[model samples]
Target: MNGRSFSSSVRVGNWNEDVSLDEDLLKDFLEKREKGELLVQRSSNLNKNVLQKAELSISKDGFLHFGEMVMLLNPENSEQSLSNPSPVYGNYTLSVNPDESAIHVKSHLTAPCGVSASSNVKPCGRNAFIITSVDGSEPGEPLCYGQNFALRTTEEFMGHLYLTSDRKSFLKSSKKSHLQEVSLTDQDSFETCWQVVYMDPQLRLEHEGLPIPANTKVLIIHSKTNQCLAVLRKYILWTLFGKECEITAHTYLNGHRVEENENHWIIVTGNPSDDINTMFDRPKPLSEDINGS
Candidate 1:
């Protein structure tokens, strides 16, 4: 995935320099707010030190863009952040794509997920720009999961990677599980953005009479490894060969989430065989440490 450009040190208010705080602690501050904690206090002190070092950017109509960063003036004291005294690190870029949607995101934090967090809308102020991730080779094999599209074409709204697989079955018949995925589109076929994956909750052994759900919520589990996969976003129900079924899929995470959430319409991509991500949970906002969103 692309690293955002909102990484530069920005003033929280009137501070002259950027104070160092724990990445994890800062993440927790965003995750759970705490009023007092030596570490949390130090973090707050540091944030207090960074306030508009450079002129804040604003749009002509007075709307914030994606690259623009916000400083936490008086970050709300939530169970997530108040647990510690470290400076608040959560930040977000208020951006709107004319064709897409108006989203306030750093996308997500550096980790798979930390915890659910909330911030006062007015207490936050503009600060810096979004820092972009390095453009180069990827870490693991490309797939339809992760922010990078693992191995698909349509980058932005058109996530063709997840659907563009000619083969219907990537996994072996010997294996059986509560859910499964099969490719339904081709790399060249230009279809709508939404995807469809057929699955059955209780599949019979030997791949016989496997019944995947048509509108059921399922994690887009990987094939070879069977590790926890991304959560399917859009869901719909349809018929197959005179039988009822469910189709689902989602934009997988790039191995990072604030914290796990249920029914959070998000998919995670990683090896199911190995250690990667947690199962599905209620959709919760990511940690608010580094960039308070």
Candidate 2:
């Protein structure tokens, strides 16, 4: 998904740089706004930081594309050079083929996924997540419950990961979840862009109400604030058919840690085995301090 480009006249704006969008799509967007069919959400400080660094846009033909969405996972209140603050390292790319209705992901992080052995040069594993639309649906269409397929292909399409509307946490899925992808126009499909963050441990646990320990990470959607958390949990569910489990999520709150109307969720990683309960019972947290240097 490198070197992706956008039409100059499309309705959606690019997050990273100022680009001319499609004229017709822009006109339609204006008409929709005048009719109250389109609502532009105000950007937050977090949104500003991300928008300045990443490129995200929606095409007139309804294709959503993302270019270079990145976040520096530095600790809060850390003193460092403006030119060189060390960031927690991670690389994630989300993309899809035009002829297919599935969303494909390539994720690599500083933390080890345990499924692969580490090397001194590139220690972590290269993992993937695939969310195929439900059955009776054509390729390049939105995914639905019971209609989605997984593991049928050679690729290891894993479990469900849901992002909250507030773009704070990514929730793991339950056995009976209807994992569907939310399109740029709020429709369900393969087109999506998420923001990945390395949060402060204390803040993540306190503000998001998650037991993130130290190394657990998350990703968010770009541009649109209210995109549906894709229901790709079908692959995860299918892969993890039997095991002890617990759901986890990152929920975003409106005010300075307000409790009312707060949004949160919990999703499980699909890598656990039959001995998962025994594994969690020990609770071996990572040894290193991830609160960026």
Off by over 4 Å in 1: 1-56, 61-67, 70-116, 123-293
Model 1, span 53-104: residue lDDT tens: 3222222322212232221111222443566555343321111111111111
CA-lDDT, candidates in order? 0.25, 0.25
Highest TM-score against the true fold, candidate: 2
Residues 1-293, candidate 2: write the lDDT tens digits.
55435544443546233343346668888886675444232212212221222111112232211211111111122222243354222221121111111111222111111111011111111122232322343444422211222211112222123221223324622223322222112223332323322233244334432212212333232323433222121132111112111111223343564311111111112223343321112354465335322
lDDT of 1: 0.25
Candidate 2 versus the native: TM-score? 0.21
Top candidate by lDDT: 1
Q: Candidate 2: give its CA RMSD in angstroms.
A: 23.3
